[model samples]
Target: MTPTPVDIPTLLEISPQGGIEGRSRRYEKFLGDMDGVYRDEHAWQDAVGERGTDDLVYWVDDHRYQEGPGALIVGTSTLLPGRYGEEFAVTRGHLHAVADRAELYYCLSGRGVMLLETLDGQTSAIELTPGQAVDVPGHWIHRSVNVGDEPFVTLFCYAADAGQDYGVIAEAGGMKNLVIADGDGWALAPNPDHTGYRAD
Candidate 1:
């Protein structure tokens, strides 16, 4: 006989400033943890030397009601604004371990871009401001780039079982495209260091 699901429906209070009122867990990424995440190594080193290792770069507040495959995981991502050479502040991107799992990122505040690419060489960059959102399809690796001067905050949701594969970008020498600062906006430039994404 099948067992009844134990999780009860609950409310999640998400703040436009970045966090869940009753988050189950919170994780932070520091400047030191972004060793090779940026394309400009020397610039990254300079920033690290100036800010030190403990400088907080980004953080996530997530609420997971259950671990089942059918469960949903909701979270808020807050990426502090910064510049490393020409590239803007970004999150260490990932493709869902399940590969076919999709996600939604809704901009709550500030300005940003959702950089997405497929293993087959397709790429897209969608800029978002307050009240904007992006529906990320499966098979695409995605990352967030903050283009504004304030904290870029977003409310994200995806399958609870869609574990992240953070190594995909590193393995590919970074995503095929880089979101760089334009005169007063942002632009997508080809990542010269990227070789290509390997098939899973």
Candidate 2:
């Protein structure tokens, strides 16, 4: 049998402050893009009024050489510190489009939380500081929450074919819990608006 051809290996310069020197793509999310992301509609609207829709909230830089199932996508997520009422800043969050795809997230700088949940109501929230990481298994819907005063930066890798189903969270009225301020620290509060997730 013939050996399969392999793709050329590439060197990546990853920044703890959030970037990939050889990144092939960059995606940014602004305050205006987070219309229904936050549970506090009133506070979100107030923030939009004060900060304007152009305010940068978070951005991602990723590198991918191939789109095949066996390929991998590596990236950095930078979430700027922010608050909408008592809630901290967060990624829009998603489950993999393929459902069974997994992901890994390693903290590069600042502090944050990896909020994970299943369709049947199981949930987990892991706090991460510089050098910490989370291995998110398949079937989990995940989101990143910035709980520090500075930007939360994380290095992430996942299957190239995972894609993303961001609408799952929106359709469920946000995740099951919210990462919010707790004195000078952070804590999780039940998201009153969550209506549970649906696989469909």
Candidate 3:
């Protein structure tokens, strides 16, 4: 049987937070009893308010396409600028269920940091700015923090089969480090709640 040629779109229009016209599903993270997921309990309380669920900390607009044996999942994460005590607004990162699936993150707008960590506790934080992109290695848990005044946005892409395992990060108490806003820049602080984290 002869296969028919398919035309791929050359251009995709992006919205402010990185949503592509008709190909986006928005997901949000709010402040609640995230104590089990964050290093700073005081900050979490302050940011989420005493009652919790007071704020929308961040959101992701996912645009995905499944093509035959593989799939392309693209997402734009927007972390709102605020403090969870000393920590900045961040995504509740996840690990790929496929274990060996790699991903790529491209800074679309705003400024922030990408926190990557392995299950064994090896961790690193990379600066995210306009025009910057980072490759996320396999078996790593990843999250993003917004340290700027405006919403920090990034476009990320990974394999469709690279299912997310957010429970791993929650069980580990978030990333090994937290991104906090300095006077005019940002600073990295150890996640006090992460017991397995070691200084590098």
Question: Top TM-score: which candidate number?
Answer: 1
How does each model score on TM-score?
0.96, 0.95, 0.83
What tens digits encode model 2's per-residue C-alpha lDDT throughout 48-121? 99999999999999998878879899999999999999999999999999889999999999999999999989
Q: What's the CA error at residue 83 for candidate 2, in Å?
A: 0.7
Cα RMSD (Å) between model 2 and the true structure? Answer: 2.4
lDDT of each: 0.94, 0.93, 0.74
The better-scoring model by lDDT among 2 and 3 is 2
Name the TM-score of candidate 3.
0.83
**lDDT by residue for model 3 (76-101), tens:** 77788777666777777888888789
Candidate 1 regions exceeding 4 Å error are 1-6
* Candidates by TM-score, descending order: 1, 2, 3
Q: Which candidate model has the greater lDDT, 1 or 2? A: 1
Scored by lDDT, the top model is 1
- lDDT measured at residue 83 in model 3 versus the true structure, 0 to 100: 70
